[model samples]
Target: MNKENIFSMASESVINSDDKLALEALEMAKSKNIDLMELLSGGFSAGIREMGEKYASGEVFVPELLMAARIMKIITAEIEELMETSDMPKKAKLVIGTVKGDVHDIGKGIVCSIVKSNGIEVYDLGREVPPQTFIDKAEEVGADFIGSSALLTTTMVNQKEIERLLVEQGLKDKYKTLVGGAPATKRWAEKIGAYAYCEDASDTVETILKWVNEREALKEMV
Candidate 1:
């Protein structure tokens, strides 16, 4: 099969959440020595992006998303192992999400992917997530951070609401809060009491690890 067909096939498998098809296409890419990163950024990512849209629209369930994420993980694992820079040590747990009223998760998905790629344990709450959901899941899992995204000015208010609840509930000191999106700025993060604000996946991953490591070191010192 031609390279274009292979790319298309890779995307279809992920969009459909067909494990067999995804694995087959990945194997084909491996054998043909195709650029796996191109396959991911071009085809597989395209498929995951469609799935993200469906998820945000309520057309797909979180389980379906888990399947898609797993497929991408399988693909990225092989690619990561071959790369020069190795993956980070998995040490921190984060509740990642998009705040309520925002149905866009494209940026959230990328951030989650990057965090997972860097070996952080991310419990993605998906798009349009309620504030309580973030707290509940983090508490249940004992996560170290509350990572949030708000693509709209309206929904960004929820970030402050979370901060308020954390203080009201006396849980403010328990978890670090991270916020981001198109309209999210460092100033806004400061105003809302978010620990940090990241502009993109790369920045998010880096900051999260740094914060987690610093916290870990402090813990060790005490």
Candidate 2:
């Protein structure tokens, strides 16, 4: 199959929540010697992006998004594991988790998978994560970005605390912060001193890629 054809099929697989089609694309990529990077950039990304768009438009609910995430996880993991053994360095490093007081895992899991598929190394800290835990894990994993999710208005406050703790530790410049969840917005991110605000898993991946790619370009220049 052609690249665009596979891309469309892969995307439709996620939209339709078809795990078999998703896996088929993975096998086709390997069989045809098509680069996994190309497959992810085209196929995997297209799928997750559609899910994000639907969620943003209120055309789909959290359950639908979670289902798509579950389907995409397989392909992303396959590509991520394949790339790890190669000479390609990870596009970026991320430490991700749900903020304290927010026990939801669906959104956080989706974002983590999307980011990982895009070639970023993600260390997911799981749900109900403390603000301090984000900072600590980032340090341990040498993460370039810290992402925290909050599903409630009250829990969202912890995202700010993460930024505050980063400043207190004199590490604000060392790591960029990203906050997301249903209630999060660009204004909130700005007020909280975050580097970016992501509306969904796809947005999170896009923003992280922008920064990671820029950093890579700068390093290449030097």
Candidate 3:
């Protein structure tokens, strides 16, 4: 199939939560020599963004979004495996995880997959992650960004602790931070001194890309 056709089918797969169609698009991309990143970003991720919108509008619920996320994960894994031997330059590195006391993994997992698909190297710290672990791993990986997800009001304070620890360690300016989840808002991000508030996977990807571009531009000026 052609690029446009494959892209269309890939998008439909996510919207419909069809794993078979998603894998079919992956196969077509391989057969036609279509760049996997393009298929991921322009096709599957595009569909995922739509799902986010629909979920926000209450047209879709958690179950639907969860299924879509699963489909995304499958296709993304395939792309990641294919690109492993290829020299796809990473745009930036990010450490992402669910904050402490929150066992919710759906939102964090979706963010990790989508962000990684955008050519950013993501180190997923997994759910129930301690605030300090984020800092520790980011330090180890030399991460450019640290992202946290909090699905409950009580657990949200851990995200704040991450900010406090960064400042306490004199590393507040060393890395950008993103905060998000069902209970998180832009105001919450500002209150906690996070770099950006991401509402969904697509928003997280866009915000991170913007940060990466702005950082690159600053380097150019320097």
Candidate 4:
């Protein structure tokens, strides 16, 4: 199969939650010398992302979404060994989590997968993470970026607390802060003094890649 076809099949496998097709797509990708990470981000991850949207719109139920997530985890595990052997240098480190008071995590999990596939080292702190925990994890990992997700308006206020803590600790300028979730907006990010507002998993990857590239260019110039 051609690369596009392989990618499409991979995506469909996740969307349909078909393990057989997913494994076939993985084999095809290997035969075609396709980059597994690219297939994961462009194909499998894309499928899960669509599944997320379906869940959000109530077009699909929790079981279907969970099944798709299961398929994603399977495919991710299959390729993880290969991905780890890659010689590519890590571009940056990111600490990510769902803010405290929000137990929703499927969306944030997708963001972590996409971002990590793009060469960023991701430290996933899981759901119901306190703002102080976010800062602590970022500092522990010496992360370049800190990302928080809030699925509820009440929980999104915790994102602001993350920003406040950064400033209060005099670490505001030390790391880039990114905010996202269903209730998070550009205005909210601005009001919280966050560096960027991500609309989705893909946007989060793109924004972080842009920042990594800019930082690399600056280092080269210096």
Candidate 5:
């Protein structure tokens, strides 16, 4: 099928909350030799963004949002497998987590989906991740960025702790760190020495892309 048609099918599946139909779109993309990234950007990512906006506007509820996210996860896993066998340029690598003391994961999961849709490689540490785990994973993977999400005031402090440990390990300059979630603010991020603060998932993608591009430019200059 054509690109427009494929995107329409995928989006309809999302709007109707049909996981099976979403998987069908994924299979169709594979069979049509569509670019996996294009499929993700146009189909799954666009669908999820629309869903999120609807959720925000109260046109849809939490259950519907979660269902769309679940479908996107399935599509993403398939695309990730395809990426493994294809000769695609690797984008920035990121280590992401919901900080310690926070069991909330929906925000982090949404951010992860959007980031991965943009073609970045993500190492998700899941929820309730300790500060040292963030440092260790970022260091171990030589991550280009470390992203922390916390839904509560208590857990948000863990973002600052992560930065402190990075400095203590003498790795503060080795990676850029970004923070987000309901309680995160630009002022808070600045106070904690985070490279950037994103107020939402869309902002998170833009911020990381800018940071990645600037880093590449500096490397070129050197």
Candidate 6:
């Protein structure tokens, strides 16, 4: 097949979460000496970003977003494994979870993929995660950021509770806290004393990156 066809096939495989096809596309790209980074960043990341936008705009629903995220995970995992032996810098580590009493995980999963693609290590805590579990895992992993997602208005309050617990335990400043999901806002994050708030998966990366960079700058100033 032509180069464009091969790339298109690869992009489709990634969007569809077809591991076998993705592997086939990888081989084809290697044989044709195509730009792997272009394939990943342009083809794969673009596709997932499109789907994420659709989900955010209500053009697509949760199931579609979940499937797209799944595909993204499969494709990126393969590429990350290859990059491990190279000179590429590793990503930051983040602990993410859906707050307690919230069963919705599609938002968290999407954020995980976006963060992972940005070269961050995302330790996903799944759905209905308690505040203490988040604290424990953040401490356990020495994570750079702790992200909490809540889909419901009632459950969103738990994000503040998490910050309170962290403060009470003297771990409030140990890690940057980020709050997100359908019900989250900058005002809410500020009220909860969170370091940042994201409205979507892509924005979350920018927020985390900014937070990390700012912290590093502060450390240097010290």
Q: TM-score of predicted model 3?
A: 0.67
Tens digits of lDDT, candidate 5, 78-185: 666655532436578899999999876756766776677677788999989999999889878989899999878888999999999988989998888989887899
Clashes of each: 0, 0, 0, 0, 0, 1
Point out the higher-scoring one by TM-score: 3 or 5.
3
Measured against the true structure, the TM-scores of the candidates, in listed sequence, are 0.63, 0.64, 0.67, 0.75, 0.65, 0.63
Q: State the lDDT at 63 in candidate 5.
A: 88
lDDT of 1 by residue, 69-101 (tens): 777767666555554233566678999899999
Worst 10 residues of 6 by lDDT: 82-91
Local lDDT at 222 for model 6? 97
Off by over 4 Å in 1: 1-89, 219-222
Tens digit per residue, CA lDDT, model 3, 149-174: 99889999999999999999999999
Residue-level lDDT tens digits of model 6 in 154-205: 9988899999999999998888899998778999999989999898777888
Which parts of model 2 are misplaced by more than 4 Å? 1-88
* Superposition error at 92 for model 4 (Å): 3.5
Candidate 3: C-alpha lDDT: 0.88
Off by over 4 Å in 6: 1-88, 219-222
Instruction: For model 5, name the residue pairs that clash.
Output: none
| Selected candidate, larger TM-score, 2 vs 3 | 3
Which TM-score value belongs to model 2?
Answer: 0.64
Candidate 3 off by > 4 Å: 1-86
Report the candidate with higher lDDT, 3 versus 6: 3
Error of 5 at 203 (Å): 1.5
Comparison by lDDT, 1 against 3, better one: 3
Sort all candidates by TM-score, best to worst: 4, 3, 5, 2, 1, 6
Worst 10 residues of 5 by lDDT: 81-90
